[model samples]
Target: MGWQIAAASAVVVVLAGLTTLALSPLLGRGRPEHGGGPDRDDEILRSTLLVAGVIGVAIAGVAGFLIARRAVAPLGEALARQRRFVADAGHELRTPLTVMHTRAQLIARRMEPQDPALPAMRQLLDDSRVLGEIVDELLASAVLTADPGRGEPIEVRALLDEIARSMAVLAQAREVQISVAGPPGVWVTGSRVALRRALAALVDNALGHTPPGGWVQLAVDVRGEHVVLAVTDSGEGLAGLDPAELTRRFARGPRAADGPGGRRFGLGLALVQEVASAHGGTLTLGPAPTGGARAELVLPIRS
Candidate 1:
């Protein structure tokens, strides 16, 4: 609305200036040539036009503001409702998911090694864990939209180690090697949970695109005032891909079609981008020197 009003005022002012220019000659012609004194008629005309232009611009600006507000009012309300719905739904799902995960774990523990249902029970537990993680991510994304929370001193190297360990099983299953490398005790200022999630998303994305026998590396470093955490994979690089489009929600790259799961919803990078923004940081995607994709999350160091 403010932008619209400013634009409208600019247009009105320009038009009024043109109109005054056009009438200047006419006003001057009406002044008596024989008078050596100041031209009262021209002076009155200039003052009147100046006042009229100001008044016209004021009126146009007000009207533009009202119109723009009315146009966007419904859209604003709809977005607010949508955010609330997502946050509420995510909250409601957490408890049930926790219970399901707990039950699956208990059932797995009770099952004998030779039991026919042991494998199925294990799969159920894994599925439940994955679902729980998804729920947490969803909830975080929704809540972060309204409140990004506070920042605190975080051990960047420790966080990277944690992420690498958490993803080790998955990487091993895929025949991919995952490693974390960086100097210890490096610190940054941000929400640890949010940063952890963002880094996890980046690693998960790298692992998904990487093929068997490939390697994924998570490297952290302090460059001046920013702490940089990057994930590089020795898989197919981002050749012929639109990096900007991939960052958009639900947007997928070309490899998405042939992905192991058959076309992903492409929410990982989007979530990473959102988390980066929430921390006043940035996420960058590019081709890694290892002939694969590289994702970098750069954040400010603790002051």
Candidate 2:
């Protein structure tokens, strides 16, 4: 009876060791079914461990994905809210501002030539017009952000010609000669209105900073798959700036408003950059070979 009991205990220890060896493969550090052992229970234990480990890894992966989604959602929502606010405010102010400007103009016209309030009223009207332009720019920017599909193809030469002609009087007032040069048949795909706005901004910047008899040149080139437009201004070049930063929102150069012949508002170049981006293009600022600042817009041609 004592020998049988000892034999039984030895068999139990051997079976336990075989089971642990089989499960080591499921722990990912060894081969399964080692040594040709014929233990059915060992096989069952190893299979169970393999399944549980796979399930644990799958759960961890899913949890990681959910955490990433939660982190990015808020940022996307915040951007959407910002664009919405700008669009709403711009739309709401348009009509009232138009009415106010008209009233101001009528009041100024009725005033006597020597009226004390005449100059102040005229200045107020001018300020109102500038504000209206700013609001319109904001609205256009917001719309472009919300819907990037609003752009269409436009003839390059015709558009530049129109902008140059429209600004002829302003250039004359500043005694700056505005000129345009480009291929007659060249074209670009973009929002005409947006392009017009961007070109107008460049021309205004040129006329504002250029001295009398200074020349501003508008040139366009179609090379390979790009439409390049350049606005060159003959004035004191940008000082103490990298030139690249001029495209950033509200970026001001060393010759900013504090210097002679600079615009009070710094949104002109920013708007140009935005327009370029909306049309899947790029805007760059550099020193013109003709001895002044140059703004370049390069748009990709549709394949």
Candidate 3:
């Protein structure tokens, strides 16, 4: 609708300008002089109309732009609403999941070694913790999108240890060794929860791909002004796949089904990529020196 009005205004302005130009000579040649100039009433009228038309078209263009923006305002509001909902839902879920995980851990601790339900309790704890992390990742992503977020000095070595501990349940179940070997006292600046989520995703991906009796190692290094957290596995080394393609959503490797976890839906790498981007970092995928794949997340050293 706005476009139609603008087009019509443009056409009218052009016609008015042409009419004034084409009839000016004829108007000036006829009739007696009027004031200091020859009679040119019709020319003057057309010229005035041409100027008015130009002004009218300019006004219409501005109005059209406003109308176009107004028409899409609802879409902008809907997106904002969606972000708010995600943030709120993540906050609401965190408390209950935390309680469930704590209670499950307590019960598992109370059970004896021979207790029949101990394994189930431990598995429940693992499942609940994973779910809570999923929520945290989604929530933190949303919050960081809204605000780049404040930076905290996170010890890189400690962060790796935390991920190793959190992922131990899955690694143990799969019979894959999890090792964290990095120099201590190395620190970086970022959101702890988000960074942990990213590292956990990497470890989870490694554990899923590595066969039972294999191993995954998390290592840290300080190179120049950046800190690198690397996760290396002992599975088929990326199957010669493109690293960029792997980071894309729903992109699975050619041998996705060959791993212990079977075919993955492929959100893990994408999530890690998002976390890295939010923290002003980079996620790189490459073949390990020995075998299998290595995923490295690099971030700037705390300023």
Candidate 4:
């Protein structure tokens, strides 16, 4: 990233210098030189200015490039360290999560139906499985964005239905009803696993804010060449909140501090936005007409 910044600064500097050099003398091109008199001096001055401008532009460009690289070096290092940490953590946790999931299944087999802890255990199993999926996904795609064309075509509506079913457990625990409510036959082209994880993140975030007895909805809307997967919740609306700021990394809403310990501020929203961008799409957040928050993940429809 630092190198990229430096390179961009250098290119901008070069372009500016070239433009000045190419156009400066032309400003007085039609005028005649009177025996190397004042007009000639004007020409000389312009020439001098042109030369000096080039030299100054070159020096400034080099300086700017170096400064930009130095300023952004720490950020580059931080990003590298973060990627390494994610890769290492994903690799290390993959085995344990699989084992945990298998053990949960084993426990489920041994437990009686009437066991009071059955529900919690089942939730644990689901959580472990989802964690494993996330880890596997992180391992497969270590970057901030995903490769949308790496998989076959996906039946989007059916995928959303499955996601709703998977999230039903979480919604039930929260006493919030979650459902897929939209036209069917929606389709897209992307990795099923990646899309599934991103959509699940959207629904999970909605369920987190929705109060018990409230409802969460996943609806699809098609506009031109793009399709929108909108998740809305009947919790408190986004009063006095900036939708753009909330989508930024590490950003949080008003109720962020009051949420569960597992909540990572706006990390989920950030990832979803990244996914949307990768798939030639965008993410929008705003108030829902139903007096709640709405998040829209819009992607290009499969042609």
Estimate TM-scores for all models: 0.70, 0.64, 0.61, 0.63
Scored by lDDT, model 3 comes in at 0.81
Per-residue alpha-carbon lDDT of candidate 2 for residues 22-85, written as tens digits (9 for 90 to 100): 6655553444545555465566566755555555456545555665677679998998999999
For model 2, the superposed segments whose C-alpha errors exceed 4 Å read: 1-66, 102-130, 152-156, 169-175, 184-194, 207-213, 234-240, 248-265, 300-303
- lDDT per residue as tens, model 4, 1-303: 567656666766676667666666675575575465677767756775777577767776776767777888998888778768877999999988889899999999899999999999999998998898888767555543334465467788888899999899999999999888878887887657777878888788778877799999988888999888888989776766888887788887655546642233468778877777756778888889998888888888888
lDDT, model 3, position 143? 69
| Model number with the top lDDT | 3
Number of clashes in model 2?
Answer: 0
Worst 10-residue stretch by lDDT in candidate 3?
A: 256-265
lDDT of 3 by residue, 183-275 (tens): 999988677888987888788878877888999999999899999999999976776678888788888866455544332427888888888
User: Residue 301 CA error for candidate 1 (Å)?
Assistant: 4.4
Q: What is the lDDT of residue 204 in candidate 1?
A: 83
Cα shift from native, residue 45, model 3 (Å): 25
Decide which is better by lDDT, 2 or 4: 4
Colliding residue pairs in candidate 1: none
Best by TM-score: 1
CA displacement after TM-score superposition, residue 18 of candidate 4 (Å):
17
Ten contiguous residues with the weakest lDDT in model 4: 256-265
Where does candidate 1 stray beyond 4 Å?
1-43, 62-73, 150-154, 169-177, 186-197, 208-215, 223-226, 249-265, 278-280, 289-291, 300-303
lDDT of 1 by residue, 172-285 (tens): 999999999989988876666777878888888778778899999999988999889999999777766777878888887654546543223278788788788867789898
Which scores better on TM-score, 1 or 3? 1
